[model samples]
Target chain A: MNRLFTSLAVIILLTQTWIALRLPKGFYQDSFLLPVLLIALLAAAYLMSRLTQLADRGKFWQRPCQLAVPALFGLMILLVWEAIVRGYDVPLVLMPEPSRVLVTLSNNLPLLWADFQQTYLKAVLAGYLMGCGLGFVTAKLVVRSPFLQKGLLPLGNFMASIPIIGIAPIMVMWFGFDWQSKAAVVVVMTFFPMLINTVAGLRSVDPLHADLMHTYAAGKGQIFFKNQLPQAMPFIFNALKLNSTLALIGAIVAEFFGTPIVGMGFRISAQVGRMNMDMVWATIFVAALAGSLSYGALALLERRVTFWHPSVRREH
Target chain B: MKPQLKSLTQTQGFAVLTLVLGILVIWYIAALLMNGNQMINMLERTGQSWTYTQVLQGAYSIQRPPLPVPHQVAMELYQSVLNQAVTSRRSLVYHSMITLESTLLGFALGSLLGILIAVGIVHNRTLDASLMPWVIASQTVPILAIAPIVVVVLGSMNLTGVLPKAMISMYLSFFPVVIGMVKGLRSSDKLHSELMMTYNASRQQFFWKLRWFSAQPYLFASLKIAISAALVGAIVAELPTGAQGGLGARLLSGSYYGQTVQIWAALVMSALLGWALITLVGMAERLVLRRRGLTR
Candidate 1:
């Protein structure tokens, strides 16, 4: 305990000194001391992480500690990036610093918002719901029929193998240059995962459970709604989590083909062409935030829905 | 040595035939439905009233239907795959080969890098703490969004062809391997770890003998995923290059010319290539795992 506090004090002191006492004439001038300070900070982070991992394993109050480690790591990375770009005078066309990307993101908020709305709020969500819904229904329909199983299940297995690049162009042509085409591509991309997952989940019911239900004279509907759906929740959520990312990917890639001149994908490709690399990075930052948030949201929902699942129970 | 043909029961054969016929019928119906507007436009242009038979006949065999009929795509595919030499630039096979060149190279490099990173993460606590979150964060930035940036920036450096495309593939292919490997290397239970400790095995020895062995199934599964991802990455990489010899470029050109049939042909080609590559990986996985008597 004493050692931990002492180490923490030293870290805080070093960081405070590094921030408070700065001596640099030109912002672009190379600073040897910056790398030295960063190295010291990195070592402190390493020690801090080791101590936390040893002492704290998911204690609720240590949440701040858990957050701090990654935040520090990210901060150090950004600083290094800023340093290299400034010191070496890397061209804007090649790579923009993190600060530049943030500035661009903040300045072009309306544009980013419009692009986000077009891609995520419209195409991605609609396609995700439709694709997963249709796939779930299809899985339900095929569950009892061996014929359907043999037919569609193999097709589902082949689904991931279909490159979206090929599908996107065709989808754009078929559905026209709008969100509908992108949604169609997302639908195509997401359909198979839901189908495969739901089918597997439905079929995964233990024969003993079926026998028990049979002894109770339960109908198929009762057996499914009462016994199977709960079990299938985890698989269903797995498909949802997988599809969330894919939906974003599908919509964005579909936009690259031909769009209404306002979408994440369209902006990215267009901005790159115009040599506005900061905007491109800004759009990418939007995409990253969107993708991660969607993924994280699905995961949280999965945890709630699949609380009974062994995988969930095993975590605690 | 082989499963007998008799294993494929009559019902299975019937189901297969039924599915093919069913898909064909659906394709024909879809073609009719999609071409309705076009057929009406054609008739209006020439001032001819639509006869049901005339429209139906034309719908199934249009020059450029939105969704090409199955037979039309099949015929187009046949011409490109069989009539055109594999060496010909027009051939889907030729484009597929070009894509595969980058895909394979990228998969190799990515797999190597992934394994090295996984090894580092597994052995070093500092790296595990620092790098793991960033690794996860990396994938959240959709590859499609960044692919254009990567291609253009790399292209500006006067780098061309397979290497640049391979880097895109590497960008995608490495993620799954790292995730899988991290999970796999840690999958050895407490009992096994204790057993290794009792034998006084070094870290290297334990990894090779136990952790690596335990990770076989995961490694193979991740390899399949990685290769498939690499194929997608390779295709996407072709997009910014413009008329470059890859399946993606072919699809782009076909789309530009409104060659729906040609686009469908390329789609089939990419689908088939991805399927074949995945199947080969799966076969290798099965063969290796089976040799070790671990089927399930």
Candidate 2:
């Protein structure tokens, strides 16, 4: 009954907003009713979400209902955001509306695409591969020697703890103001997480597997290749996923220090001087999209590679 | 992995020493390559020729190098951190305190927020279903990307210095705490939760007595990660502000003038700051865990 009442109230409030939004320009322009309409819409959305939450607890509708709750909440936020920005005549410089941001994103696709290519394709991918490759090889070496594990791991941690901001300018000095410098920053930022994870993963080899290998008189090479490496795949992928985020962050921030003509960070900082709020929002959107997609891809790849893991089994 | 007070192996000690020395050696080599070129050119300008020893010495002792050797950086750090009075603008300790103030403040605020959110999610099913994904998505949006916007927006509100930087620190620090805490809060066994239920325990009673206690390890683990992250955030915030103080400003100015030794010194100071904070948290963790009779 509460859900029904809330739903009814939401529909009524939304209709009122629609009416207010559609009212004659002279009536709507100078009136305070728009904020009132938006406020009501926001409240109704909130109550409706509470209703949806209660509704979603049922087993039969669990999946779709689970999706609905957040979707509704997000939609409500965007709706109110759009309405508030448009209604208040907020400065385009201060905060561009989502619609304007979308328009800028669509209109300037070529610019954003170039920035993405520069930041993601050039800097992130190369750095990620090199950093992870170094870390993996180093982990293999460290696994063979207890001394390396004890010593180099701490050393790597120390190197990693230094923020990318500190290393980025130094990288520009070393590699110059190209994607190479950004990539170098990404490499340094990513290297230690991969190292730490791979080392931990190496230790995750099952003792039973080791015992079985010993029974077969397996050499170190055979044991590592057949048992240890395979077992470490999940942890290695964990680092890869983590480093994806770090790599993007490092590349972008490095661009802020110095960059070629085109990159997300360059565009963001440059355009802000011109008060191009739409462009800034668009860049942030692109970054968020790239970050999420990279994480999602890594997750998907992890599932494929680690199908034997129990967590993977739970999916199907 | 635990190093005991006794039975210390010489190999382990030598391994660490050798690694440090290796890094120093490499730094010296790079310094010679990068810094020596300028020195060599200077010598040429003065109608003089130099050999390898001279280049090496010049690399180490040059007023400013593209890459400073370890000793040069160490000397600079000594001059800034030890010789300078603590109140001096150039003293690393003075700047570090500026950064640390914001880091600690942000960390405290963020941890409180994360814990509050985690507790809400634990108790309220709606929040778990709705808010958790948003929290995850929030972290995926690079904090660095929005940091400038945050700085500008908050700077316009007549708020400056610590609060804006603290906001960034809070952004970086809160995620781990929420994730760690949620996982920990949910880790209570079915039997244990059932026992609490059977005793007619209130939700508040169950949480404080059962859930929060169980969550201590996760909280501390997250806190360790979060506190170090807060320092990083504070430093990053300092970068865009062109501020008069803090390690980031020191680094920025050093780089602007090609004062690589000063940059390296500032870098070293920031590292020490991170190390000190992490160590403090570790000590606190040990004390709390010991008091709780939890040895992990």
Instruction: Give the CAPRI rating of model 1.
Output: acceptable
Error of 2 at A200 (Å): 4.8
lDDT of 1 by residue, A253-292 (tens): 8898899989998998788779898898888888878887
- Model 1 stretches with alpha carbons more than 4 Å out: A1-41, A44-48, A54-60, A141-143, A200-238, A304-316, B1-13, B115-130, B155-159, B180-215, B291-296
Looking at model 2, residue A12 earns an lDDT score of 62
Model 2 spans > 4 angstroms off: A6-68, A140-144, A197-241, A299-316, B1-14, B37-50, B187-206, B209-214, B291-296
User: Could you give the DockQ of candidate 1?
Assistant: 0.41
Instruction: Give per-residue lDDT, candidate 2, residue B125.
Output: 65
How many steric clashes between backbone atoms does each model show?
Answer: 0, 0
Q: Candidate 1 on B1-296: residue-level lDDT in tens? A: 23564355435666667787888888778778889778989898999888888888888777878888878889999999999998999888899999999999999999999999999988876566667666756776778667666776778788777888899899888987887687677766667777899999999999998989877876886787789889988988887766369998887888888888898888888888888898899899999999788664
Candidate 2, B85-165: lDDT as tens digits: 999998999999999999999999999999999998878766776776667657666676677778877877888878999
